[model samples]
Target: MSGGEGGEEESLEFTPTWVVAAVCFFIIAISFAVERCIHYGGKLLKKKHQRPLFEALQKVKEELMLLGFISLMLTVLQGTLSKMCISEKFVTNMLPCSISDKHKEESAGNNTATMEHLGGLRRLLSESALSQTAYCASKNKVPFLSIEALHHLHVFIFVLAVVHVSFSVLTVLFGGARIRQWKKWEDAIVQQINDTDPSLGHAVTPIHDHAFIKDHFGGIGVHSSILALMHSFCKQFYGAVTKADYLALRLGFIMTHCKSNPKFNFHKYMMRALEDDFKRVVGISWYLWVFVIVFLLVNVNGWHIYFYMAFIPFILLLAIGTKLEHIISELAHEVVEKHVAIEGDLVVKPSDQHFWFSRPQFALILIHFILFQNAFEIGFFFWIWVQYGFHSCILGKVKYILPRLIIGVFVQVLCSYSTLPLYAIVTQMGTNFKKSIFDEHVQAGILGWRAKVKKKHTLKGSLTKPGSSSTDGSTVRIQLGGITQKDAGEIQPVHD
Candidate 1:
């Protein structure tokens, strides 16, 4: 009879448990791979002078981040499911089986047999402990935040940050270093330019310099060739580098910019040059990064998928914030480059009428966008988890999921509350941009503002006038760059 019962139990379905779990893991892996290949790959290809490769990289990164995000969301959905088991605990927890006596019988005995069964529950609890522990510990003992849930979430997030940040920083550093290396190789060319030039250094784009620098040293260039040298290497079949991994890329850009600023001393440049190192040290020293690291350390006890799901919002929000800053910085650079400086000691001349985008307006838009998206997402997350848990609870197996739902609610609420300050920060950033633009354009020449100046003539018979001088002896002069305040009979070059 025992053998027959055992056979019957063996024949019962196990509910395709691994199928869902495996699919979740596979999807996550694929998502990261795609994102890394595209974003990091494009960045690399662009540096290589391979436009095709660069284009490919961008296409890939976009597709990957999108797909990965979707897949991760789906995996989160799958976590609420359970393997259909015969434990009376499920019946008691889900249905009116609490009073059904069978569950009481199951838990009543302190005998060896009952103790053996109790061990299994303990193990299950340990393995499934995710972010919903408090909920899991309640009278109902819902399986909200299981260890498995948090494990996956934590690992995915950690890897994402580490990979992307590292890749970005390394890319920047490598590009910057390579450019420097190439410069060394081009000693002869540099000398030639130096012998005949005073300002040519300002003109050579780092791209061209890279080639010449390497060519001069007889070293096989990593990115040489008019065509793609290793197209296969450029394309990731499974995994590509992520934004977290692109420290080098970021450093390279910083170094490139630092070199251009005349006001930056060697110490300043050095600090910027070693920014990654500083970030590393600070990351280690700072409590937040350390908290994350330590929180990850708890994974050594085991893994939790819920952590992965929880981390999604955090990572996405931070990435969006960083991307916003990058865009703003780019715009700022353009504004600074073409803006004309005047006597006001500012870049833009006073009385400039037209304006496109002020820094403040642009920043405000971004801040609004981020907060809006965050609000919508947090709301959606809560809605999904709550609905799923409530439905499961009605079915008598709410076990772990219900607790997770409540915890999710609390977390979401807290994050929503925090968004207010974040919104303010973004708004302030926008305001600062607006101020910058206004400052640039302040005191600009206006049609109605009459200039009063005294004109003096030198032996050469050239008229000299001070901008602030009274108009007593001086003729009313409407002046701009390349425009002469001399006789109106003389043609003055109009300024744009």
Candidate 2:
């Protein structure tokens, strides 16, 4: 009877290897083709003036990343299901041996004999035939491949394909928005020039003719603005500014003018504001790169190692998010300072200090990190646990699920609450450093002298005027700061 049962189990365990292989091949081929199209299409759109095509490709890339993430999650679910099914089958086969022993004992009407028979049977099966039966039950017609191994490989390929598809999406959304915003700003500046001085309206040169706008407002405007803002803050702290600081201050003024103007697209205004700072923090850390590479290598080897490496990306992402918060806080502080300087009577309130974080863009980024990025990270590892058959036994299931649940809760809390503390630390450190420098300058008697000299120079420069300040037969002089006094006065503060 046992032999017949074993044969039936073996027959039922057959896995269609060719079908799985063909499906995997098709998936890989399709993923490769789609990825190639995204890559070359992005490049082609970039070279040409195909704004719509480029934007479409960028959107497609983001969607692909989302799809890849979903596919990986599904792979994990499938893996868990397969393991559970296999384990349940093993438990079912062991049940018959126990049932037969109970029947024999009941017929004999002896409890001790029944117990002895049960023990003997169990021992015999465990010591000899259990391995053979399990091997047979697990085996399929796929040469040396067992059903478990085949399932694992198929899930692995599916995950790989998803990952490839995700990374093929490019981050080009910000570029197109930037160009459109600049063109609008140029038009606004040209209109302002024509409105301010009607006599030279016919001779008012194009926006590109303005050297300051062309040099600073071209492509690297955000970068220039950040550097300029940082310099201005440094100058305010330390009365005597360096050449670098002065240039940065000039850039900051230009950025503020562009940002404060009502004619420009505020949504696309400061898209790349914190991008450079993010790159600076993440790129300079060589050890993080090494960790990333090592984790990838381990992930490719097998599920066991991949399980540990899975959380590394989440941790790195959280770190990046925290750094971004810090950058935003710094930006907010600088913006408030600029406002206070421009509107001399305006006071900086505690609420104004946190204004940047409340902005639509910052809020959107925060929501994405919490709702999308963190959730994806948690789902990914949850899938990993389920996929590797770690949840089969009671002990294994507890070991796999319990710690990860706790970790996930902890990670969520950290990502959400830790941003403010990190931001505070960064700001506090800068404040302390600036205070210390100011104290040193005061003690050396250089602070007061420098302030007086700057004040006197400003007064003299404002009163002085050049006679030949004309461009293209237009008497409307383009100030070195990218805006005349009247234009500056007309500029409004950005509400968002």
Candidate 3:
């Protein structure tokens, strides 16, 4: 027994000091080296691809700024509203007259001493007991709900409405700014390309082949065609253009594609525009719903049963829905792949692999379903709150519910309808903003330099007629809209 005890004590001994120190030192050195390498690599990447890095940084900054603004607004709203609801005066005003009077009377009496005596001599003779009782006799007399409480609750709802409306407005404004910026950049890039290489201008086809696109790829097809076109275009013009010009060409292609295949339906367009925004908002609202649900279940009797009733069926439905969606997605992918293969379109390949289900994708889908269900549940709870408060009003004593509900519904409808207009406004704004910035910073300087070079070249060429042939026997002709004019009288239009 003595030997076994001694062995157990030895097993429980701590690691030696040198061993622990060495391990920690190794970890620190490795971490420092990794950090330095990462920093150096990032700088190298930024130097090589300055434009892309700048754009990415700008995007991240904008997103973070938006997130920070929203968080600050929410924090202020919660703090102010909570303070108002929990104030002593507000709590006291919320209590009923009868309860207030009873509480006052109970507080005036010395009931603690009587209760202490009734506990027998053993309680009264405790050496450590205080002369005054610590318990509050009137603690239970306070009412949970009062007039002030109802008022504050209405105020909270109004604040939430205001916040939602403000968010929508901000989103619209920011989107517009981004659109304005993009448009300026596109115009500059187009002008630069036309000036430098007029022959290449013919490649910038007006994207009006909507019917052809739809027939070939179906609705909102994968970006394989665009990718293929970009690859071929870049390869053909390799080393002939600057990085900025290449970017501009790609942007032009995308814009042309979008303009040609416009979604005519307003609702569909709105849905697509707000899809990412809605997903983010819904994610936040789901977290709020979870907190509310937990609070309600803990404070109110029988609430857990209702939660179970809703949650169980929702889980079952979600499983069925996800499975159905998976099947449909697989079928669509297979059909697209088969069509592409048969057409022998070597320029583009179908993206069937991207549609395959993976662990991470499945997890994302599950989260989406949870958020969707939570939104419904939150709305249902709000309705219940309204109904309960309305029924408890007792002949218009609590008169705020109807007006609050009406205002909230009206505001909600207005915001919902404004989504499409907001999207259009935001798009336009962003395009304009992008164009202005690009012109002011990049295009203006380059255009000025090009103008001087062109002027010198024109002076040298002025000795001969504009349409005169060179030593190589090739005639000098002007090309406009993909049509070359050998002579003014022989000019003719070219059709696609």
Per-residue lDDT over 462-492 for candidate 1, one digit per residue giving the tens place of the 0 to 100 score: 4434453323333435442112233434221
Ranking by lDDT: 2, 3, 1
Task: Give the clash count for model 3.
Answer: 27
- What would the TM-score be for candidate 1 when compared with the true structure? 0.22
Local distance difference test, each candidate: 0.34, 0.38, 0.36
Q: Per-residue lDDT for 272 in model 3?
A: 32
lDDT of 3 at 373: 38
Summarize candidate 3's per-residue lDDT along 326-404 as a digit string, tens digits: 3222323344454533321111211223232522133324433333333334444464454333332211233433443
Report lDDT (Cα) of residue 244, candidate 2.
24
Candidate 2 residue lDDT tens string, 201-279 = 3433443333332232334343465654444333322322122222222234334443344343322222222221122
Evaluate residue 26 in candidate 1 and report its C-alpha lDDT on the 0 to 100 scale.
Answer: 100
| Leading candidate by lDDT | 2
C-alpha-based local distance difference test score of model 3:
0.36
After TM-score superposition, the amount by which residue 235's alpha carbon in candidate 1 deviates from its true location, in angstroms, is: 19
Task: Order candidates by TM-score, high to low.
Answer: 2, 3, 1
